[model samples]
Target: MRKIFLFMAAIISAFAISAQTQTIVIQGPNGKLMADLSVPSLNTNEKKTVAILMHGFGSNRHRPLLRAIYDKLSECGIGAIRFDFDGCGDSDGEFVDMTVPKEIADAKAVYEYVRDLPWVSDIYLIGHSQGGVVASMLAGELDKDAVKGVALLAPAAVLREDAIRGNTQGAKYDPITPPEYVELPSGIKIGRDYIVTAQTLPIYDAALQYQGPVLMLHGTSDIIVPYTYSLRYNDIYQNGSLRLIKGVDHSFNGYEKEAADIVANFFINTVNDYVL
Candidate 1:
């Protein structure tokens, strides 16, 4: 009985020390958005840097990779905020009809939301898959001031190309399945309800033209977005760098720990001065 009591006490104490994680809500112009904000107590009293995590298409902040990234960032003494895109998770709006333009606006709303925080000294953006594309378009304007550099995680190198894959005349619904693709669980389908905007091409171009100190990380075997996306765009940034992990897939299979470490190192070492 004494051992059982001691074990329970230890579990309770463990939870108390890691209570830095919290779910927070921020209001957009139209409605409210929810996110999990967590930071290690390293600089709890002092101002610390912040990173906003943007998840991929059809994924909210609750995605496994996002949560893993958040935990990784928190352990590295960096404060991170991850939220659901509009119409997904706890955020307002409809995602079925959402487009890149509207999603970018939502990204901007979240960025603005982070900017208003008192303890945030630097605002960096970390995005995965399609989220990386959205972050890239805003890289220039978002980094103008207060915003920092951007991290592109398995970004869709050719977003419009991917978006139009079976979109004959922008009509019809074809699942984004593949022999070489990441093999996302069943029931995930391309959102055909959305109308592709001209913004997609421009965003792709801007992502390739972005000159900031961008860190592009992609799995070598990622067929979903393909690692070539990062390789082909390496020269776009004057200070851009790429790290292609070996034997990794689109979702970075079996390598979340390594991926998280690489991401943390980039934010710490590369993005400090890039933060405007």
Candidate 2:
């Protein structure tokens, strides 16, 4: 009878997990984009907090690592939403013509939309790679009251700086590329019509002054963005700290299970601290 009960519990748990996640498309200030929303199965019994996941540059909402993280967060009872930034994912926009400001504007729109969801109790932002910069900007200047915390995973210290130093190998996919040879991922093509050139300094600078609790994580083995960047960001922010994961890389690469655990744990703990 005990074994039978346990088997039934497992089947119920699987159903619950599947019901909590659904693919969605939303219209932001710029245009429509693809997003994946997930929630913990147990969360339906009670109100729960939410964390929004933003993927890295040259990536989309369906990246495996991010999907895994979202799944884990859902299992832990936190609601999650991951989307492709305008012009980047299933959203409508010209990727090369986009600037940092445009992306930030889109993120702001997402924040507003998510906050209005009937099931949300609180909202948090979690970003990876370039997405970290977007989250940081939103955390500081979001026009909404629902946003409660910020989390950066290998976020770029200075987006431009990271770009200048990024592997030219990856530049090829940039809908807009630097004067170097490299392929960008996610179909970001580089061309002369680039709309987000360095003049967008206003957006980048504004991020430094963000006002909110921040949590940064980076791995030492990350060749994409240095772990030192996360440390510096943590040092500068009044309400944050950087946790270095030894031997980890930019995408958390081979550390999927561990990375998901850490990201979910951070979401839980960060929200807990803010409420008190």
Candidate 3:
């Protein structure tokens, strides 16, 4: 009987989530970005806050970690939009042509779309790994008031350093004269443009522009991108806090729910008023 009740509860929860989700498409720099915007099922009188969720390198909006965060935010009566950067997921671009600048453009396009929405009262940014870098840079590009707060999960600022070192995901190449493309161990080929731009990305210079509240959550055991990268962000931001989760990996493998809760709580506390 208990098992049956749990199964029924899961089904109901899935139904509720699907009912609130909306498919949105925005024209990104390279192509159309496929996105899912999850808004709380609130009445007209209730206030709504939305967050733009960005995924990491070679990841999609539907990644387990990202989806968990999206669901948690929605459950808290917060609106969240998770989208595929051009060349990833269901988007309309090739992965080989993707770059940091292009991903930023994709994020900017989504931000503009959200800013124009009439129902959204406040906006926040939440990103993981490479997506965290894109979110930081995009928030810096826009007005501080535009983004109420930012939450970065295992932000991968080490990409720039890796580019300078001519090594990416254990794939080594000559930084001075990189080939047309370098393929990762996963068999994904990144173009030369990605390497060249990553080598000199004004990541911190642009990220620190937004002097708003920043919450950085990184794991002590993250081997892909060291936790030191997030520490650097915390040190540079005018108002930033870093929380290092011991024993957690870059993907927050065993702590997905905890990581999502942190991001949801950060946005919840930052917002002046919300439905739930």
Clashing pairs in 1: 146-276
By TM-score, who's the top model here?
A: 3
Clashes of 1: 1
Using all chains and alpha carbons, the TM-scores for the candidates as numbered come to: 0.79, 0.80, 0.91
- RMSD in order of candidates: 7.2, 4.8, 4.2
Error of 2 at 135 (Å): 0.4
- Which residue window of length 10 is worst by lDDT in model 2? 191-200
Per residue, candidate 1 scores C-alpha lDDT tens digits across 130-225 of: 888888877654545545677888987566765447332233334353221222244333344342452135765666445657889998888777
Per-residue lDDT tens digits for candidate 3, residues 139-158, read 99997588888899999999
For candidate 2, the per-residue lDDT at 257 reads 74
lDDT (C-alpha) at residue 111 in model 1: 84
Q: Pick the candidate with the highest lDDT.
A: 3
**lDDT (0-100) at residue 181 of candidate 3?**
98
lDDT of each: 0.71, 0.71, 0.89
Give the clash count for each candidate.
Answer: 1, 18, 0
User: Once superposed on the true structure, which residue ranges of model 2 sit more than 4 Å away at CA?
Assistant: 1-19, 40-46, 143-145, 162-188, 191-205
